[model samples]
Target: MSLTHSVNMNWKLLIGVLAGLLIIGMFSGSSGQQSSSAGQQSQSRALEASNSVEWKKVDFLELELPANIQELRDQVKITSGKAKFFDQEIFYQTGAVPAGVSRSGRTVLLLHGAAFTSQTWIDKVPTLRTLAALGHGVIAIDLPGYGKSSQASVPDNGEFLARLIQSLAGKQPIVVSPSMSGSFIIPMLANPQYRDLISGWVPVAPVSTGLVASFSSQLLTPTLIVVGENDRSLGNRSKEDLKGLPNATLPQVLPGAGHPAYLDQPEMWHKLLHNFIIKVNQANSAQFMEA
Candidate 1:
């Protein structure tokens, strides 16, 4: 084989070895015996191998959320470090934010998008924790089969989601979702039990477009639609889909951004979400909650 071919083969083999070690370390830690130092070392080696890989795309479209054990406990109800909602398996990695104690006490229910696991937040631990510390009561959940919430059910998207919200949402919650999750979110906004319980909605890169059926036809809750520049073509057409709802607002476009702006562009997302929550709280604080 050519020298270059030999080098490539060697690199692939190294990566595979490192990956296997990481997985082994991960499972060993599952017994609550993996030392923090070992986990950090493994993570560092993993990032090094990943960075050495060839460039595939600079404009990645996925947004990653947080993936830490402490965060998991703070936001989720885990058993065997897993949660099953519906028929799908999910790895329940939770966030650090407690349910907020603001007089308004607004809770944020985070929903994952298509084909993504909560592993998205594997690199976003700091930012997520910061938001949690800010008293946002952010509950970022990995849908069924995603994150540590794996080994669960994957029932009908909308109904299963409603149950998840009811179980997780401690009070009047503000749903922050993306892509196809909006189908489930919009319906929850109209369900009587949840309708009176929903305070605000912030949909990022939602797939609520298309002529498909939806509960958008039923909601009257106030919302903020956050869109990334050069986002999905369907999301690009969201203006048409979100049109004419009484409490619906226009999209807040993120510059130099595309889909998954919340995770892909953490600083911007953090700022926008923080400000948006503060605004919603001011407008509907405990004295005048309309929901």
Candidate 2:
């Protein structure tokens, strides 16, 4: 063959190789783009699911009207009810539901300190009415021997609380307890089965039981610890005890308050409870979506 003919043949072979390379590159680029688009779509769906189904807004107007603090205090309709626990009759005071509002799945159990009755919640601060206005079912109970309830010497307060929680709320409900009531709640936290029954916990200046340090590392329940700035002994101890809770919020110190800070700073107390409940609900929704 002549030299020019051989050179032309070589050139043709080089062009063919280049063309194959270009086609491969184009296909790979297209595949990459498609994969990236699919990833973006998946992320968008996750976000939408998290946001769309998360927290729900309450229809305040449809519920009973506690327009002002005074009306909330005076308008509280008290009812007597009995629960049979271990063959013992336990009496409790439950706030009456309004004409149109549904009570199902909206209850918030309030446990007061040893010093006060369930009425302390209604009389001192407008917490019940405020929560009611926000569309929560409020049940402030007087532990046996307090308020209008019958007296009983309970062997295990924790077991009693667990039973109460199951009977009062169809599902897990937000529990708000202050001072001595913390002792009742601490045992539940230590028990895995009982702890899961509670959705969230708000403990205010709870008396320390020395058990918090043992279970704090294992606690999974969402908690908000509120303490009075002035009640150094109990408040500081509570904060230290909660240090091991992985999902717990930093201690919230109420300003210009003492042991019973909720009464001293009613507005701040109400705001904290409202926001914490919303946060817990949102987290629950996100977990449900992931599942």
Tell me the whole-model lDDT of each prediction, alpha carbons only. 0.57, 0.71
TM-score of each: 0.61, 0.71
Please write out the lDDT profile of model 1 over residues 1-291, one tens digit for every residue: 899999999999999999999999889877564453554454333233323322122112233333442453355322224444664554444444445423236667777677565555435423345455456555667775455555555656667767666777666577877876766765555443445456667777677545323555445555666788778675576645665444555566777776776655675676666666665565454324322
Runs with alpha carbons beyond 4 Å of true place in candidate 1: 1-90, 97-104, 122-127, 190-193, 211-217, 286-291
lDDT of 2: 0.71
lDDT of 2 by residue, 1-291 (tens): 999999999999999999999999999999988875763554343334334332223221232333564454455565657777666666666666544544334567888898987778777877776676555677777776666664664678789888988997547788888888887788876775576666778888787646887766556666777889898887888877874565667778898899888999887788777676666666667767676
Candidate 1 has a TM-score of 0.61
Report the error of model 2 at residue 112, Å. Answer: 1.0
Q: List runs of model 2 lying over 4 Å from the truth.
A: 1-78, 96-105
